[model samples]
Target: MNQRLKTIDLARGASVFIMIIVHTLWMFATPDLQGSSLFGTVIHILGKGTASFLVAMGISMALSRRQAPWLLAKRGAQLLLLGYVMNAAKFWLPIEVFNTMPESFINAYGWQSPLNSEQLKFMLLTGDILQLAGVSLVLFAVLNIARWKTHWIATLAVAIALSSEFVRGSQFTLLPYVSDLFFANNYQVYFPVFPWISAILTGYVLGRIYQQKQKDEQYLYKVCAWLGGALLIVGAAWLAVDFKGQFGNFFHLNGGGISYLIGLNLCALALLQYLFANKSSGPITRALLYASKHVTALYVIQWVLICWLMGVFGYHTLTLWPTLYLMVLVSLLTFAVHKLYLQSKRTTIGVMQKTKRTA
Candidate 1:
C-alpha cells in the first residue's frame, strides 16, 4: 500500500480528460446539439465521470501510509472549504470583478446582471464534487476510527444505494447547503452523498483487496472483469427498462447509474493497469501522471476558465465545430495556467524552505 499505484493515477487522468470534453460540451454546445448528436450523447453517457475521482481518492486513501483519523478529517475539512472557494472564483468573481457575465448566463441561472445578495449566496453555496470529496473523506475517517471491517463498509454502501432513491430530493429548508450535500435534487448540488458516497466506499473496499493482491495482477484483472461485467449487465438492463429512473436526469444518478459507473471505472482501471504497469515511461504516461498528480488543481482551473469565458461565448450558443474548437482552446489554456501555477508554487515552497534553513 505504501507503493504508488500508477494505474490508479492513469485511471483518474483518463477521467479528467473525459471531464474536459464533457465540460466543454456543457458550457458551449447548443441544447439541441447536446440532445441530438452522437458525440454529445456519448459524452453525456460518460457523464461527469466525477465518480472516478472519488474512486481514485478511495484507492489513494487505502494506499496512503498515514491513516490517522485526524489527518484524514483535516484534509476533508480543507477540501470542503476549497469547494466553496472554488464556487466564489468560478461564479462570483466573474459576476463581480470581471463584470463579464453575459445576459445569457444570467437568464439561464435566474440571476440578475447586478447580482443581488441572495443570488450571490446561491453562487457561493453551490455543491460540487469537491464538497462531496470533503464530506466523504470525513465520513470515511469516522468509519476508520470505528475500525469497521471492509464487509461492514460494503454493507453500508449497499444500504445507501438502496435508500438513495427513497430520499432523492429531501429538502432542508433551514440548511439548504446541508441539503445539497446529502439529498437535495437541485441544479446547485452536483454530487449528492447518498448514492455517490457508495461509489467511494466501493472503491475503498476494492482498494483494500487490491492492496492485498497487488502482486497478483491476474487476480486483480479477474475481479475487475467479472465484477464489472456483471454489474454492467444488470445496470444496462435496468437502464433499458427505465432510463430516467436509472440515471435521475443527469448529475443525480440513481442506484442503477451508479452501478454502471463503478463497473465502467473498474474495467477502465483493469485496462489501464494492464497497459502501463510493466511498461517503460513514455510521453503519454508521463502526461497522464502529471494530470493525475494535479487533478484537483486542474479541475478548479478548467472550471474557472469555462465560467469566465461564458461572458464571451454566452450560454449554450456554440455550434458543433465551434464548440469543438473552444474545447481545445479551453483545454490548452487550462494546462498552461496550471503549469504556471505549479511553477509559482514550487518557487514559493523552495524559497520558504531556504529561509527556514537559513533561520
Candidate 2:
C-alpha cells in the first residue's frame, strides 16, 4: 500500500504487458516483420522486457528482509520446477492449428523433429530457460551466504558481468553448464553471469533505495525522479550509437560494453521515478499495480500462454495490425486470470487465519 512501491508495481505491470506482446509477436510474425527497420526497431526494443524482469527480481531480493536461507532456496527451487514444467508442456504440444498450414513452416526452433526421445530429453534439459533460472538461483544462494555488504554484492555482480565477456569467447564456454551457477548459452546468444546477474544486483540496490526513501518528503522523490530520468537519457543515447554501428566489433556482449543493459536499467528507473513523483492514478496504473504484485504468477502464466499459442499455431504469416490486436487481447485475458489467482490466494490465507483463531 506504499505509494512509492506503487511505482514498482507499475513498472512491473508495464514490463509484463510488453513481454506478452513481444512473445506473441515472436510466435505469430515472421522474422522479416521484425527486421532492423524503423518499425522493426520498435519490436527489437520490446526484447528488453526480460532484462527488466530480471532486474526487478534483484530489486525484490534487496528489499527482502534477511530470512532463513532455506526459505529462499525453497522459493527459487519452486520457480525452477515450475519453469521446467512449462518447458515440458511447450515441447509436448503439437505445432499445427485449425488445418491452416502455411508454406515454409518449420518445426519449433527448440524442438526439432528427427531427434529421438532421449536426444530430445537431453536437449530439453540443456537448452531451456529453466536451466538458466535454476543456475541463477543456485548462484544467488551462494552469494547470499556471505550476506556481504551491499557494495561488495554490487562489486561482485559487476565483476561477473565483465568476466562473462571473456568466458563467452573462450574454450571454457561449456563451464556455464557445469558451473550451472552463473552462466548459460544458446547458440551464439549468451545470458551469462555478468550481464544477467548484474541485473539482480541492480534490483537489490533499487530495493534498498526504496526502503530508505519511501517515507521521505516530496522533494526527495523529485530528486530521485530526475536522477532516474538522467540515467535513462544517457542509456538511450548509447543505444542509438550502438544501433548506428558506431562501436563496430568492440561492442559484442563481453567486450566491456554496458550500452543496452545500462540503457534498459535507466529506462526502468526513469519510469519508476515518474510514477512516484506524479502519484499517477488511472485504470492502467491500477491494472499494472495489481499485475506487478503477482508478478511470479503472471510470468509463469504468460510463458505458458506463449508456448501454447506457438504449438497450436505454427509461426504462419499474419498481418501486422491484427497480430498486434491479438496480442493485446491475449495480454488482457492473461492479466485477468492472474488477478483471479491472486484473489484466491488471499482468500485462502484469510480463511487459514480465521481457522487458527477459532482453534
Q: How does model 1 score by TM-score?
A: 0.93
Tens-place lDDT per residue, model 2, 39-60, is 5568657665555666666666
In terms of TM-score, which candidate is strongest?
Answer: 1
Alpha-carbon local distance difference test for all models:
0.82, 0.58
Error of 1 at 49 (Å): 3.1
Deviation in angstroms for 26 in model 2?
1.1
TM-score of each: 0.93, 0.76
Report how far residue 220 has shifted in candidate 2, in Å. 8.1
Q: Which digits, one per residue and each the tens of the lDDT, describe model 1 over residues 101-188?
A: 7778778886567878988888898888898999988987899899999889889987887787789898788976787789867878
Error of 1 at 211 (Å): 2.5
